[model samples]
Structures are given as C-alpha cells and as structure tokens.
Target: MDSSSLIASPSLARRSKQLFLGTRLKSEQLDETMLPKRVALPIFASDALSSVAYAPDEVFIMLAVAGATAYAWSWKVALAVAVVLMAVVASYRQTVHAYPSGGGDYEVATVNLGRRAGVTVASALLVDYVLTVAVSISSGSQYAAAALPALSGHEPTVAVALVVVLAAVNLRGVRESGALFAVPTYTFMAALLGMAAVGLFRLLTGTLPQVESAELQVVPAAGFEEPLTTLGLLLLLARAFSSGCAALTGVEAISNGVPAFRKPKSRNAATTLLLLGLIAVSMMVSIIVLANQMGMRYVDPHQLDQLRTADGSALPAGYDQHTVIAQIAGALFADFPPAFYLVVSMTGVILVLAANTAFNGFPVLASILARDGLAPRALGARGDRLAFSNGIVFLAGLAIVLILAFDAETTRLIQLYIVGVFVSFTMSQLGMLRHWTGRLREVHDPRTRHRMLRSRAINAFGLALTSVVLVVILVTKFLAGAWIAILAMAIFYFLMLQVRRHYDQVAEELESDEQDSVMPTRVHAVVLVSRLHKPTLRAIAYARATRPNVLECLHVDTDTEETRELMRQWQESGQEVALRVLHSPYRELVRPVVAYTAELRAANPRGVVAVYIPEYVVGRWWEQLLHNQTALRLKARLLFRPAVMVTSVPFQLSSSHAALQRRERDLDRARPGDVRQGRPPRSFTRR
Candidate 1:
C-alpha cells in the first residue's frame, strides 16, 4: 500500500473550520502577528479598564448597607484603590524588564522562590482568569438586560452565548481579535471619560441635574440604624475598600503578555502597564466622585427593599435600579438620548470585551506552566491560527460552567473575584523583593546598586499594599464566596504537583540503558486470521517479507463450521505459512489468543514475538463500528507482553476510494501559508 493513501484529506469539517477561523498561518508568520502599542492596550488592558463599570457599583453597594451617609467615604476608598493600582503597575514594570519571557509572576516566583512558589502563583492566576471571564460576561448580561428588556430573566443564557462568541473570536488569533475589539474598548474609555468631564463642567457651572435615585431614601440594614464607633466604621470601610480593589484585577496582564508585543517587547509592555493604570484609575475615581456628588444610590440588585421613596413610603413594585454608569449617563445627557444610549451601550460592550484580557492572559500563563511540566503538553501547542487554542477553549469551558452554576448574577460572582489575583500579586511582589535584594549583593557599581535599591523599594511597597489588601479580601469575603476561590486554587496546586511528579517519573523511567541496544536472538512472527480473505493474505505476505526466523497463521476455533471453512480456504490458497489452531470451548476469542501469545513468549524469553493483525479501513464512521473489534482486542492484549511487537496491516474497502481521491485533490490545492513556507504550487500529473 502507498503511504500517501494514509494521509488524511480535507473534509467538510475542515472547510467549515477554515471558513470560521479564516485561513491558517504558518509558524514562520508568528512574528507578523506581534501587536503594536495601540492594539496591545485593548488586548491586555481591557479588563482593568472595564473594571470601572462595576468597581464603583461594588463600592456603593458595600457602603449602602450603612445607609446613604456612608457614601461620603466612597471617594476615599477610590483613592486608596488608585494608590495601590499605581504601586502594582510600577512593580510590574520592573518585573517585565527583569524577566521578559512572558512567564510573569510564575517565572519570578520559580526562579527566586522555588517550584512550589511558582506553582502557587500559576494556580492563583488560573483561578483568577476563569473568574474574570465569568464575572465580566455576567455583568455585561446585566447591562444587556437593562438596555433591552426582552433579554430580562434570561441572563444566564445570554451570558453563555456571549462566552461562546468571545471564544470563537479569540480562536481566530490574538491580532485579529485585538483589532476587532479595539474600537469598543477605546469607545468605552472615551464615553466614560467624556461623561465625567461633562458632569464636572456642569457641576462648576451649577447646572448639573440630580440622578433619578437622588430623591430615594436609603434604609439602613439591621444593626446600623445609628452612627458607628471607630471600630465599626473601620470595619465597614475595609469591606468597601476590598470590594473596590476589583479595579486592580487585570493590571498584571501586560507583564504576562510581553512576548506578544513587537520589538523592544519589555519596554512596550511596561509602557502599556503604565497606560492601563493611569486610564483605569482616572476612570474609576471619576465615576466614584461623580456618583457621590450626584447622589447616586445603589444596592444589591436582589435587595431592592433597602430603597424607599422620598415620602418615607415603600417604593413602587418592580422598581428597577439602573447601574451607576447608566444613572450617571442618563443624568449627564438628559436632553440628548443618543449620547446616553452610546455611553450605556459602550459600557455593556466593554464589559464583555473585558473577558478578552483573560482570554489572552490565561492561555499564555497555561503555556508557560506546560513548558515547566506543571500542565498538560497540549495546552502549549499552537493551533492553525498560531494561537494557544487549547488553553482558550479550556478557559471558555470553565467560565461557562461558572456562569451556569451562579445563574449569571454579577453580584454573587463578584464575591469570588479578586482573591486569586491578589494572591498572585502579593506572591509576585514578594518574589521581586527577594530578586532585587539578591541582585544588590552581586552588583559592584554604585549606579547599578542605587537603581537596584530603588527597584527594591518599589517592590517592597507593592508587597505591603497587596498583602494587606489580600488579608482584607479574605476576611471580608470568606463567608460570602472567597473560600470557593481559595479551594479552587488549592486543587489546582495539588493537581499540578502530581502532574510534575508523573512527568519526572516518566522521564526517569525512559532513560536509555546499555541493554536497550542489544538485538533479539530470534524473531517469531504470527499473523492473526479469522476469514482467510484478502486482508489475511496481505498480512501473511507482509509478515513473510520481514523474513522472520519463524512465521505461522493463528486462528481461534469459536464456531466449528466457520473454523472448518477457514481451514478449507487456507488449504486451497496454498500459502507458504503454516496454520495453527487454538480450541476455545467457551467460545471466547481474545482470551485464547492471549494465552497462546503468553505461552510462546515464555518458551523463548530472549526472542521477540511479532504479531501482525489485519484490519479493514472504512471511510464512513458507522462502517468502522462493524469491523476491527477482534483485531483491536487482540492487539490490546498482545501489547502488554514483553519483547512482543504489534503490527497492523489495513486493507482498504471500496468505500475508502472516495477518501483517497479527496486526499489527492486536497494535496493539489494550494493552502494559505504556503508562500511563507517557500513552497511552490503543487501539481500532480497521472502517467
């Protein structure tokens, strides 16, 4: 048989995939996919930027538990979050320059701390990435429901669909998805900042109108009817601050994606990190301040009982409270409805695109873990589009499961957010501190030492801030949902440790030895036969061609009549190979064959036994189920015997001719990446 006939041909599924994902690119074209600064911003920073849409809402929701009086502390909380965001961004800038291989925190922790520390950081990041997708898409679904009432009561379905679409877009390739998403991300930034600017101007001119919720009175929850003491106030403020820290969820993506940037990758990534921090902080603080000044009141969506009318009466039935951005936009552009819709719509779009950051970051981190033997090797393979497609699909599946489990409720899912990210942040910053401290000892020059010391200070400050934030998040949200994230991190850590151990064991077991080079003393060949047909003849001829020391045809006697017919056909065919029959009184096929092979191996332990099984090749999938069952079982049993080699000789059926022709046609057609691979047009002329 010609080897070319075995090559798989392009099928309907392959064509459909090409149509959906676009043409495939060669590996040599990977450098062509590198992102510029403008594109990289939206690809890696969209999550941090989009956090403004919900971070402010979380802050207000946390404070609303103590009535509207607590709203005054919103700006202070926002300021603290901004300070931490800046410090983190500064710390990661040093990280990118020091280790620009796209390993980000995992690399820093592994090199400086140890493999366990690195695996810890990797687990934290993985959990956080999945949560990022779930939370962002769920929030987007909320906004979508608010904008289109028809989508109400079906947020989970909508969120799941959105996740699927995002996964498809990302599967196309990073550069293409980045380009497709750049407009929405940028428009979101412009709309939000522009609304803030307009609102500030109206405030100075004494013409800013109050939001719809301004007249509504907030009812304090139980035990908070009066003013609080210092301890109580501090605890309440800590909860609010922890919720607001969601703004810093995506700041580390730039460091994780340094390799995706163009030349001077580290410098470009560091600059993008700075831009993300500045933009995200500016938008977050602006929303918080504006909402406070405009008397924007927000509570948990499910807890509408906390709100009352201005007349001290219970609110109307089914009163929908719009999000902070929606209310602010509605008031800011009361006269022009189009501008209001633009701001609100773009907010929703950005929330969904924010998941793109996780799509980009999670796969890169998973690939790094794979290279280090902590993850499955499949996660490190590039797909047709030169993307980490296996990792992308894995992340999408996880996000979808979370969305379905939580009913796509943003508030509920938000409780599980921030814990994993902060864990990675604190560990990475601590690792950086050690990294700089060790570097300071080796540097002799005064200038270099001073620079290292400065970097060390920045990392130290970042470590302190992130560690405190992490403790606050765990304390405030443990009962809420943060423990779920912690449990997930622990599971991932243990699984990865086991995976590394398994890989190490396999490597040690596969090490070459002097005995591996020794040749077998003799070769005994056995051809499995059932029907003494064309397939059996081909297997026997191929076995004979190998010129073994001994060869025979073995058949199991299950049905007496069938066995007699096979023996008669063997005699008529007049084959050179001898025939051996094994009787099975219980009508078993696999056991009798296995017992015979074992006896042969025990007789000559120094010789190698070669078993050739004839198989039928069918084109249709259903036809495959009707054939190859016995051969498959025999091969499985024979594979376990030491010094035994199994061979499969396939006889193609008439149905397979169509597949052979299709393969030939596919080979003649030119593919998309052929030019980059320096391959000429393929032409096959029949003689």
Candidate 2:
C-alpha cells in the first residue's frame, strides 16, 4: 500500500525471475504458447532430421565388420531402414490423429492394450528419449571435433556443456526455445539438401571426386576374411540393417509432441511427421548413395588399415575419421572447400539441436505420466515459463550422467540407441492394431468398417516390421551395449509400476467420507517458550485467542540459571498463565518436546493438542540460518504425532517485512491472471 512497496516490489520480483527463468509470464499469456508449423518442425522433428548426420555412419560401421566386401549391401540396408521409417511415420500419423493429447505411444497402448502395456511403452519411450539426447549430442561433439581439431580429445566435456546450454534454453519455454532453434534446424536441412543435390549432379555428369578413404582397403575381421557362410552373411546384413534403423529412433518425437502444435494440432503434427520422414529418409539415402558412388569407407577409428596413402602405406597417427556427412561433403566439394566446412558446421549444429527434440518430447511425456500417477507429481507441474521444468532438469541430469559414463562416444552410445525406440514402435503399432480391431467391432457402417480394416492393416504391417527389427536389434547389439538400454527400460518400467502402486495405496488411505464427521472432544493448547520475551508473550496471546479448553506454558529446562531467571521473570510479570518446567537432563530440546506432545496425545485421544512455538522470520539468507533451526527441528519431530497440530507464531523483524514484500511482488507477477481463475491476490494475513 506504500510507495516504496509499490516500487521496490516489482523490481525485486523481476530480478528474482530474471535470475531463474529470464522472464516472467502471466497465466493468460500461456494461450500464445502453441507453436507454428515452422517452429514446431524444428522442435519436434530435429531428432529425426538430424539422424542423417550419424545414421549412415552407423550403417557403414556395421558393414565394415565384414570389410569392404560387405559395404556393397550398405545401400540396401539404408533402403530397408527408409522403408521402416516410412511405415512408422504413417502409423504415428494415425496415432496423432486418434490421440492428440500428447501421450503418444503410452496413451495409445494404455487405451487399447492395457495398463501394463502402457507402462511398457512409457518405459521404452523414456529410455529412447534419453538415448536420443546422448547419441545426438555425442555425435554432434564428434562433428565438432572434425570441424575444429583443437577440440579433438574433449568430446565428452563439450557434449556436457552443450547439454547444459540446451537445458538453459529449453527452460525459457517451449515456444521461445522453438523459435531459437528454427534457424539452425532449417539451415542444416538446406545445407544437407544442397550438398546432396550437388553430389548427385556431379555423379550423373561423371565428375564426382573420390573420397579420401576411397582407395584404402579395409582389413576384415578375423572370421570375415575367407568366403562368407550363409549364416555369417545373414548375421552381417542383419547388423547393418539394425544399425541403419537408427535413423528411425526419433520418428516418434512428433507423435509425442502433438499437443504443442498450433490449431488443428493433429493434422499439423501428422504433416510434420510426414515432412520429417521424407526429409530424413531422403537425406539418409542420398548420403549413403553418394558415399557409395564416391567409394567412401567409414570404419572405427581404431580399425587396422583405416588410413593409407595412394601407395597403400599407412598414414600418420591421430588421423580422425570424419562423419559420413563430412566425408560426402568433402568428396562433393573438393574444389570449393567452404562448402564442405559449411556442411560439416551445419551438421554439427543440427546434431546438437537434435537434442532439443528430446527436450521437448521427454518433459511432455513425463508430464502425462505424472498426471496418471506413474511419475513424481512434481513433474506434472509447470514452472514460471509454463514448461515442465522439473522434468527437463531430470532428463538433462540423466543424459549428462550417461554422456560422462560413456565418454560421449557415438559408437558405444549408438549401440544403446535404437533398442528402446524399436520396442516402443513395435508395441505402439501392436496397440494400434487392437485399437482398430475394437473400432471395427463397433462400426456398423460398411464404409467405416472398411476404413477401420485399412488402418488395421497398416498398423499390422508396422507391427510385424518393427517387431522383426526389434528382434534383430536385440540379438545383434545385446552384448555390444544394447543391454544397457534394455536394463534401463526394465528399471523404469518396474519403478513406475511401484510408483503407481504407492499412489494407489495412498489414494485409498486418504479417501474421505470419514466417521460421520466426528469432532475432537476438546482443544488443548500448549505454548513452547524459551524465554520471557515479546515472542513468548505473542505466542501466549495467540493461544488465548483460540479459546481452547486447556492452556499451559511449557519450557524445557536446559540450564538451571536460565530456567530460574525465566521463573523469576514470569512471577515479576504477574502472568496468569501457569508455566510448567520439563526436565531435560541430557541437554536436549526437540526430544523432550516431542515426548510431551506424544504423551498428551495418548492421554486425550478424543482431544486435539495444538503446540504453538515462537519462530523468528528473517529476510536475509544468513539471518535465516541464525534463527528458526530449532523451530524447524521441533516442528518436524512433532508432525508425526496423531491428534497433534503444530503452529508457528512468527515474530517478524524489519528484514522479514522486506522479504514479505518481495514474496508478495513475486506472487503478483507470477499469477497476474489469477483473478480469471476466481482466486484473490496473495497478501499477508495477520491474526
């Protein structure tokens, strides 16, 4: 109500929010939160679109296991992966249309298959999103190293820093972060598409330059040198196909983020999904084809004969294996070096932005799970920027830990990449099959039934294909590192089940309807006094204001001199309230208070005992530490006693008033539109 309050309040509130979330937004301002298609494409599709940077390399790495002889089939593997990508995109389009609540596979499975199936899908998607961040950022760091040799040996540290930066950006809100990322996403797309076009043009004109590694002969693994057996070839091709399918890992992100779209959410999301599929598949297939036409060979950096000059002699040490996109760019732009650098730079930027897709999808999915009682309820709450802030930080922490553990090596991380996604894809498609089957049972119209059957067929085909890919991925990458992902999924699944169980048990126990609205027989009030001071006098007055059936002032005698002085002061003050001293021979405070409260509760089961403690409300941080520690400890110990309620009679110092004003300003700024929700502004109330 004062001028200083009106001025200082807003400034302090703005400073607090600017320190944390950079800006403060009102509740009504959230209507502008929906994303336009251009922004949404970058946010929801970055993971899939950026996969082209590393998916082809994964394919080539698997093929290199059998040496260059097996590289001939790499394009076939890429094509097969592209087919699966199209199927998944098509299937998820139906999902977004049918269930646009942003739950994606978890919602679909729960609605169609069952709760267990839903939990299974949720678990897999959770693991998939985390791996999406790890693999994408790790690969981005690799591209960074290639672009700047000075950063060659610090990929993991660079990757962690990138994650931290991304976490900060996303904390700014979905639409804001989306706008921030749009340029990089689109530029990366244009760079890759332009490079692919130029590479294809040169190839058609028969002027395509050979990659640096084209002439280097790959030394095969021990068992692969001789003529391949039937089983050996099948296993090798399966590995290649499985690795190629990493391109499909992030296709579900659009489905998970359907709610973040503008008007006509489902249609926009489906369109985005289609665009993601087309762009990703085209770039992936084009990169693999160009790499093949240019006779490029990608192998593990530690592989034998990875580098050889035109004379077939070994090149010098510390030679980095640039990524698939980098190699293709180098080959296509042999005469124009900047084009290659442009491609590489954009590739690295996009790969880092790729994690933004996971940042968007994971928190939304976790929010849904939290709403359904599977995750911590805090994850369901939005922060100052109206984003699921807790979930975002949780994901960033998990990803950073994984990056540190794996040293940000894409080769090791990619092995753990596609397993969870394929599990989610297979189960989601299967759930959709059941969804359509149930719909067919209800649709009496012939035309509608026909459409249902068609959708069912599509989902069924997706189910079969993804199921087979899941099996192949599991078998081929199990020991190679996929087991880590599988174990993670299993752990999340069981943990969520336990969380749901705990929530259920808690709900059942807290169910109200009570024993005919029974009331306590009487109210017994106790004032905890440390000394005869204004705070103690205030506590006594508040206790008297309650007009309880019984009232007493209690003090714990920790020191004889202090207790005697307090007794003499009470007598001299002529206080009517009787003061009782409790002996604490062990020099304890909280224990004696807790025991007395418990004893009172036991003695009067039908009565509610209210314990009022005097507390100091301080503004400064160190001032807070100087006071309230004892009051907080006592309150914590007293809360567990049945039929006992603890109250704090706070004595506000001058500093406390300042803190109160700042808090009021913050609340006012944060909930400016709370009146629309029929709630009054937050103002301090005094008794």
Candidate 3:
C-alpha cells in the first residue's frame, strides 16, 4: 500500500508518459523575428485565400437544393459577394491606416462607441476564431478526401492531425514567418486561375472536358418543388448568399495583424489587403463561372440521392460526387490528372493553412484584449518567441474539439460559419465610418479632410452591404444552425464583460495607498504543533524572536495519551506557558483549534492571529503522499479567514533533496536539439 507501488510501474509509466505527452518541440525552432510583407501576407491572408477552395463548394451545394436551373444564378451570387468583399476590403484598408495599433475592430469600436462596444467586437472575434477553426478544418478534411480517397472516412482524424501540426508549428516560434505558407497560398490562387484560364480557353476552342459529376443531376431536397415561385426563389437566393459570404471570412486579418508587416507597415498592409481582395474576387468569380459553364452541382449527400435519367433510369446509388473545386479541377485538368491532384492537394493544404490565419490573428487580438483587461492576463504575455502563444494554443485546442465533434463534416459545420466573422465585419465597418468622420472633423486641410470623407463614404457603403448580408446570414441560416454561432458570440461577449468587471473590481480593491507600507502594530506568534517534532521545534524558535504578549504552542488532541505525554514533556522543559490542548471527539482537530483561535480573537479583535504550521519540504515529488492530512487542510482553511495569517514552517525530508537535485541537474543538461544542431532547439524538433 505504499505510494510508489500503487500507480508506479516504472517501465509502464515511462512508456505512457512518452506516448501521451509525445516529444516536446524545441524553442529555437520557432523563430520570433519580425516579418517582411511577403511572409506576412501568406501568414495572415491564407485564411481569406484558402477560403476560395471551400466558398465555391458551399455556393454550389446551396444552389443544388433547387436543381440545375437554380445553378445558373450561382455566378451572379458569386459576383455580388465579390462586390461586398471588395467594399469591405476597401473599408478595412482605411481601418489599418487610421487604427494601426493592432487593436483592430475592438479598438475602433471602443474609441468611437465606448468600452461596451469594444468588448462586443472582441467577443464576436473570439467566437469567430472558434468557427474559423471548425469551418477551416472541416473543409480541409473534405478536400483531403478529394485528394486522397483512401482517407475518405477519416475526415475528423485528418482534420485533428492538421490542427495539431499547425499548433506545433505556431507554438515553436513566431519565426515561421509564413515560410511554409507561401507556396500553398500562391499555388491555390494559381490553381484557381489556371483552371479558369484553361476552362475558358477550352470553352472557346470547343474542347472542354465535361465535369465528372456533370452527367449526374441533383434531385431537389424535400422542400423545393418543380417550377418554384418568386418568393421561394428569393429565399433560395438568400440562402445561397449566406453561404457565399464564407468568402469574406478572412478579410479582417489585415486589421488584426497590422504589427506583423515590414516598415511602412500600415501602407504595406493596405496594399496587401487590396491584393487579397483582387485575388479572392478573381478566384471566387472564376469558380462560379467555370462551375456554371461546366454544369456542375453539389448537394448534401445525406439527402437527395433520388436523381434519375430522362429515361427514368437511376445512375449508380453510391456514386460519390466531388466538390466544386474538385469537379472543376477534374473537368479542366482531364488532359493532365497530375495537375488535378496537385490542385486538389494544394487546396486542402491551403484550407488547413487558412486556420493558421486565425491562429496568428486570434492570439494577437487576444493579447491586445488582455492588455486592455478584457481577457486573461496569460494571453497578454508575449511568449519567449514574442508571440501570443496562449491564444494560438487555445484556438488550436478549440478547433480540434469542434473537428472531432462534428466529425469534420463541412456541410454541417458551414451552418455555423460566417456568423462571427460577419458580426465583427459589419461592426468594424460601422466603426471605420465613425473613425473617418472623427478624423475629418479634426482635420482642417482640404485635401486630407476630403480623403477622410471619401474613406467614410467607402466604409458607409461597405457597412450597408455587409449589414444586409449579416441580416441574411442570421435569417436564412438561423434555422440551419447559425444560431449556434450567434449564441457562441453572445456567450463570449458576456464572458469578456464579466472578466473585465472582475479585473476592474480587483484593481479597485488592490490599489495601494500610503497606509499599506506601514508595519503592523505588534506581531503575535501562535504556532500549531501537532507533535514535538523538528518542524515544531523550528517554529517555536522562529516565533520566539517576534516577542509578543502571546507566544505559545497550540495543539489539538484526538487521543488522550499523546496529549498527556506532550504536557509532561512541556512541563519537564519548563517553557513558560502550558501547551493548549483543544478536544476533538469527532477527530475534527481543525475545528477545535479554529474555535479556540476565534475565542482568543474575541478577547482581542485588534490583535492579529499569525498561526504557523509545521510543513514537510520533500525532494522527490511523491513524498507528499507519505504525509497528508489535517495540517495542509488546516493551513488552507485558515488563510481564507480575515485577521488570520497562516505560515508554513518548512521541515525538509530526504525525498525533497533528491527531487531538488534532479531539477538542478536538468538546468545544466543540453536540450534535445541544442547540441546536435547549430540551429535553435525548436528547428531541430522533428515533425
């Protein structure tokens, strides 16, 4: 029944520890250096760019609910969403210029609207970060299936793995600088553009290969009927619009990461925003154009598998329909299958990297919010590599949970998408309009004032467009489960408000004054001694130095013999006062001692009760198991009561010395990668 045998089979424990914790990544691998614009773009903009991979798929999937005739409108919807994205991007460009402190929406809203609005914006962004992980990881898994058919049923596993990889890479160091990100980002844009180009060229040449799923027709779900009414069409369009809005999910990155760019950071960020806008628009429109051209359609495989040919013959029952990009890639790259797989694989990689955008942005925004006392202080600390590490790890953990919960089903997860992003989006745009107006009012120069006015107009338009989309997203997607995201945002908002209030109350309570520096009136020393041990002896000597009206050893007895022996010993020693023995028939020693102390305090309320307890200082971690009971519990309880000060008198045990030596030895040992490689510890850590 010893502590070591109970759970300590050394070989089994060691193996389990290695398997469960895995190998820790070295710190040197994660560089914390500043980034140039090239690296920053892919790091921060990957989410927006990676969104193209899934945004088109979501649009086509939504349109498929109403059959192929409804699919023709997909291109127009894509264009409309693109227009809004451009407007939002233009307005955020203004945001980066005016508010380059990295506060982004929270700052803009707080400055114009006040603290409540800032917290509201912060909450929305926090929830959006959760959705960003869920959406991006789910979609990434879907793409993974397309790229690697063998991994079809393993979506959640793959997505979780992807999250772990991204988290490790991010936690290693801020020095990732988007180096691994560049090719995938650029490749995704190129794949979409190339598909568009080749599709268009083949169309003009009358040689375009048909999409794989083009021959198959999507049967309408239970709701939609043939020859749909105008009202029904409008509702369907609204739903499609809501889904297409996923394209705008990553637009706020520039604002969130204004600090990450090179010199002239704001201007570089604005230009990058413009580039992001153009690239996103081009790819978004191209996918719709190509899908519309090739007669591609997608649907939630859970329903609507009842399609039959014109002759009433059903195609195979278990035929798998590829995604929008997959279908398009299959069609456009028919002459080049390698290109098809390349595009699909890269698309998947980029979608996972898209979450990396959230990874970078979430932590930074969290750190800023934490600095403002709106979040946990842990988030505020810049990690060793100078990144918001707490935020990154937090986001990664959340994404993994969501991925596992939803089984990485993009179809279901998309329902929770865009709610947070658009909430922050519309609020941020409105905040920007106020920002411009405020600037214009301060500036007397005609040109500068006019520029502010122009920016205001752009933001005003963006606010209107985004607000409309926001309303649509709420209305159309609410029943489809957008409510979950909205609820999450509300929870985050209120949680932040509560944290801020708690911090504010603590600050008010803790603020020091001149009275705090003065010494106490007198030091009363009361030592709690359960036995006449070395710890008790040390406490008695230490307490005697204080020299107060009350200097005595307090003991609680559940047994009569031990108390008599102690009393006999105390009398033999002739130490001034008799040892106080509090009775405990219930074996409740702490209560009796506490009551005695309270009785003493009632006689003298102005006096302090500084009760010192004997405690073991062990070297081996498991030594605490050998000694546990009333002492630890008594000290903890006493510390909470007002006017009562509890102190621990350390009595070192043999095990404590060994454990301390082990820790000291660890400090001198070379880290895993430091000696073998010239690079820092993090770089040498294997994937």
RMSD for all candidates, in order, please: 2.5, 4.4, 5.1
lDDT of 3 by residue, 595-635 (tens): 87777677677777788777766544365566666676676
Candidate 2 segments exceeding 4 Å error: 1-16, 306-312, 658-687
TM-scores across all candidates?
0.96, 0.93, 0.88
Cα lDDT for residue 407, candidate 3: 84
Error of 2 at 256 (Å): 1.0
Candidate number achieving the greatest TM-score relative to the actual structure: 1
Looking at candidate 2, the ten consecutive residues that score lowest on lDDT are: 1-10
Q: Which candidate wins on lDDT? A: 1
Record all residue pairs in model 1 with backbone atoms less than 3 Å apart, i.e. clashing.
none
Candidate 1, 119-206: lDDT as tens digits:
9999999999999999999989988887789999999999999999999999999999999999998988899999999998998998
TM-score: which is higher, 1 or 2? 1
Question: Which candidate, 2 or 3, has the higher lDDT?
Answer: 2
Superposed Cα deviation of residue 467, candidate 2 (Å): 0.7
Using lDDT, rank the candidates from best to worst: 1, 2, 3
Q: Please give the lDDT score for candidate 3.
A: 0.78
Roughly what TM-score does model 1 have, to 2 decimal places?
A: 0.96
Q: After superposition, how far is residue 175 of candidate 3 from its true place, in Å?
A: 2.7
Off by over 4 Å in 3: 1-32, 143-154, 218-231, 310-312, 404-407, 512-522, 573-578, 654-687
